[model samples]
Target: METMRLSSSFTKYSSLSSYSSFSSSSSALLQTKSKNFISLKSVFPANSIPNGNRNLTIVSASKADDGPQQQQHSPFWGGESFFRSVLASMESVYLNKNPTAKAILERVHSVDNNQICYDHLAFRTFGVNGHGIGSMANFFLDFGYTQREELRFPEKKLKALWFSPPSLPVSDGGSGVNGPLPRIFISELLVDQMSPQAQEIIRKCTEISGSGNKHAALASALGSLTWEKPLYSEFQQLARESEYAAWTLVNGYAVNHVTISTHHLKSQLGNIKSVNQFIEESGFKLNSEGGVLKVSPDGMLLQSSTVADSVSFCFSDGITESVPCSYIEFAERLILPQFKNLPEKEVREFHRRDGFEVGSADKIFESTSKEQLTRRA
Candidate 1:
């Protein structure tokens, strides 16, 4: 086994209180009118049709074997093309709502003209009335993504799964103009495990305005809350039991966080620690719950995220309050031991650590927690 190591200087700096806190009141919410239903026509523009039949290879690491395996997929069609639009819309919605993320992307662009590559796009949902991972997974599954391992967070009453994307050539089906496509990480609150009172609050909201399986993905792509505006009291009640539930109550099916793959950055920012330092130096605060750098027990996967921004939400009672909104995340998947001997140029997505870590992700989930959100204030 390879020894886990990180820069001593980076570790020391990460432990210090160097980030500046911003007043949440100064941040304005990018509010949109609630839509009863999001039409597919709105998501799929006329020009968004498939240009050509493109064959792609899907890669998956076999748990029963040492080396990675590849499977040939059929020619690309409307699914892959439509997924691109979905991603574009989700990113647009996220950037429009998250100024902090927009500024960070601008900074990256200023440094290098290269487009940012995503590690994964995360979504949070409630597990009730056909509104959980199954609703969201179908969209990605239709796009040639494969379901991977399941991760559970007993303490948070949450369960999540990460999906691997079909690897296509740069011009064909990757995330941006270059690099590999990002994985999808969707987590749902374990509603049944919550207190009866909290469960009732969630049940009422979903029952009143839940988007059935048919339109769940559309609602997510539009970044629309499928449910009616939640009451402040209900939000508080859920927050006391499970902060995850409270977050989903207001920001239903919205992109929870878009993770930047630091290793793919191929620059000084490629190092996870260096990227965290740059983010803090650039004036954004990171989630410091388990320190800025969250590492897996084996240390191959390292992650960090900005403290979630505050959004001005109008409650059901017509009272507006600043609540936690989505934020940005950074991840660095280190090269596996077997791949360490290979030339740097030969390393591919499979060469590095894949999937997610429960321990690291558990902390990453706290990006939107009140404790982390308080840092923004």
Candidate 2:
């Protein structure tokens, strides 16, 4: 529950996952965000992380004159972990292309790799309890090309690698708790020398010969590689297809993360407005309306309204047995609808007559996605 996990938050939820046909978009978004989070794994010496092309690594900041301030307020917190995740991911991509030619490399090939990546993070999520994030996001940081590329490594010459999150907060009063350790870690082993067949495959894959230009693809694929979590494109496609209304998409990459983190912000998400209003839950936002809000169907009181609050009621005219919150935790939960349908105009008229302002003639269920995006620009 975004509101509960963060306690202090929630954002708007425009619709439900099953509002339309069930789509794979939710899974895609989960996977994509997980991929971005894994991007921050770093091999740099001691607490350093990359910010874009610069060595904005944590070590450099720590070495800076800030002293205790830096120690007390380490950069890795909440969603800002996305930045760290991005750095980790970049290193992974770099390794993907420059696999020590002869130094050997490792790989991951299926659900098997999932376990390895999980080991790297040492983090576990049992369900989609946070917004839609939970267990699906448990191993995001060690996934992607690092684990995936292991499948493409030179046969017989494969490397054995294991990793875990170096970022977990230090335990309070542990056995000889050492100095702050990294959340980025990877253990490696070299396999037999590259096979001639494997070498040839690499040559073919990296070929720059006439009619075979793979460098461009490689460059495009690896360029600006990051671990920062992202909203998957499949999620977008699904949202478009779902009956759920939306407000706007968030572009967390551009924001000053040291102040506000993408993950921290995203943590505020709820299934939809009706579930709960947790802002940082999903980075989703509305116009001037406190970003987004969800009101209980029975919670509304037409009799309690005046021509004053500039509010109105639009009834779906169905009995809604909605669960308290639809965060992934309650996956098996269902709500039975029990009401009659009414025309949009009649619902609007009743609401206006009650006392609230009806949105424009075009908007339905009071969604302001267009307005929010337009104003965001």
Candidate 3:
């Protein structure tokens, strides 16, 4: 299967592989809000990560004398060992549902000297204290990621926060090191904002999961459901109001989708239109709410995604029906003409857009809605 073959553009930009080599010479003190609760501190030296034009660094904030405040370097999270585990875990689940992605991964590795490029990974959660966005963010924050931006969708009763990964120093100049790390978008359904019946059902699911020692489960934001399954009637009711909440109740805090940056694929597939055409021609249906492409106001960012796959789940009543599971997304960010002439560093920080567009994301969230899935079916 000669699926989308990532050009050297993606192969050369994998900074996730760089955290392996750390020097003992330079190290920074690191601490988390609750070191005892979440063991996030690790002692590793600063090393370069490969991201075509992006670099991810993990450090502790420190005050400097003459120059700007320097990022006191800390140990990389999980290092290479943990890095491989994380990718493997995510790939296992993502590939299971998205054969399209599996084909692409196999194709890339078949040629050797290549790896897939991930524009971003998104997770859906309930808007609860220790179990929602705050808890999910901790997982990434432990790995040196910091919150960058927040977005809201009152109509959908949802709120999202985007996190940026650590970056390498300017002295460690390399291709694409100027760009930021692959984003991690975490959104939580406003359960309290839902109808009383909906809220009670969600609360019950959380209660079931919290019955035992949940402290250990807080470390990870992905995996199989920790709560009891809902009755078909309850699930339908929740889905009727907010599919996102119903998804979390059944699927728990798992990845909703992984985004691919079409801009990076330009060398291989060209523009967003080309990418969408290729996927559609390959037999995948795209989200049509805002059309196949959702362009930002300034026309700098464009987005699209495949309709969620119909995954069947058995209700407590012993009935199974297929509903939306997960999907793949594509994003293309245009460089401002003004910044196009500037150096790559300036362009990365000032020109290329970061974060999500409210209207675009609002529709993207519908990928898993019953209406979208039924229409595609």
> Cα deviation in Å at residue 358, candidate 1?
0.8
- lDDT tens digits, residue span 166-233, model 2: 23343332110111221221111111132344323223322322221211112222332111222234
Best by lDDT: 1
| Greater-TM-score candidate between 2 and 3 | 3
Model 1: colliding residue pairs: none
lDDT of 3 by residue, 273-361 (tens): 88787777767778898788988776777899888776778999998977667887888877645446766544443245555677888
Best by TM-score: 1
The per-residue C-alpha lDDT of model 2 at residue 228 equals 22
Mind giving the per-residue lDDT tens digits that candidate 1 earns over 1-377?
11111111111111111212211122232222212122223111100112232221212232313445432321222223334555677777777788887787777655644546788889988887777776676666544466666677778877776677654545422323133557889888888888889989888977887344445666766777767898899999988988888889998888898888887775677687988888889889999978889877777888899998888999999989898889989988888777689888977676677767777788989999888877552
Q: List where candidate 1 sits over 4 angstroms from the true fold.
A: 1-79, 172-179
Clashes of each: 0, 58, 15
Quote the lDDT for 191 in model 1: 88
TM-score for each model: 0.80, 0.18, 0.72
- Minimal lDDT window, size 10, model 1: 1-10
